[model samples]
Target: SQQGEEDPQALSIQEGENATMNCSYKTSINNLQWYRQNSGRGLVHLILIRSNEREKHSGRLRVTLDTSKKSSSLLITASRAADTASYFCAPRDEKLTFGTGTRLTIIP
Candidate 1:
């Protein structure tokens, strides 16, 4: 599988706080994307940053990619209970492989 591995199988944060998660892949990739899954639902694309890019931000989401280290990090600022969900990072390919994911919980 081309899927990368992510740390912190679960995370609990309070509302208005921040959450961070990391991911590491084995092979090189063109781009990496962060997705959020609510309970037993489909994944929602949060952000995507190419290998040529170091960092990208969207609203409360900030993502950083390091090709040399084959790793990436996602940061969510001022998190809310509505943001509670599992986050998975995957490579941008025809067959996208997903990691186990980080189960995030935001306390209200």
Candidate 2:
């Protein structure tokens, strides 16, 4: 609970369908990140949106905005330590729709 609260925590959709998740936050944020997982890995970066940005798109992933509390530290630490190329940000909107068939790779 250090960041945005995602709704319908568990979601199920068909292979070609879109999966939408809502994240509502109290305060404003700078940027937001969307992560893709492959059942094995934790968070695989899918997209990034900045505070000044209103929206973003990637293959089948769309991000608006969300509110996160203490996750800033976790995001920053992970980026610098693991060098896992993880992504983070504060979304401006409250909805996220991920395309189940899309794939993305990030290197930092």
Candidate 3:
């Protein structure tokens, strides 16, 4: 599996605070994608930044990719309690090879 690893397996943050997670992979990739999973529901695509890209943003989320180090990071600013969820990074492919994931909790 060309899956990456997310650090700080778990994190707790208060509402309105920012949350950040990092993912490190083993090999070269065509692209990297970030997704969010809430409880038992399906995972939702948050962003997808290609290998040639350095950074991208979507609303309250900002992502940075470092091909040299084979790593990526996701930052969620102005987080709300409703943003609590598990975040995972998956390499671009038909069937994604996802990371262990970061279990994030936003305290109300």
Expressed as tens digits, the lDDT of each residue in 31-85 for candidate 3 is 9999999999999999999999999999999999999999999999999988999
lDDT of 1 by residue, 1-108 (tens): 489788889999889999999999988788999999999899999999998999999999999999999999999999988999999999766569998999999999
lDDT of 2 by residue, 4-108 (tens): 544544444333334455544455655655554554566666567676665566554566542334222121111111222223333434554332322222223
Local error of candidate 1 at 82, Å? 0.5
Q: What does candidate 1 score on TM?
A: 0.95
Looking at candidate 3, the ten consecutive residues that score lowest on lDDT are 91-100
Instruction: Flag regions of model 2 displaced more than 4 Å.
Output: 66-108
Off by over 4 Å in 1: none
**Ten-residue region with minimum lDDT total, candidate 1:** 90-99
Q: Which stretches of candidate 3 lie over 4 Å from their true place?
A: 93-95
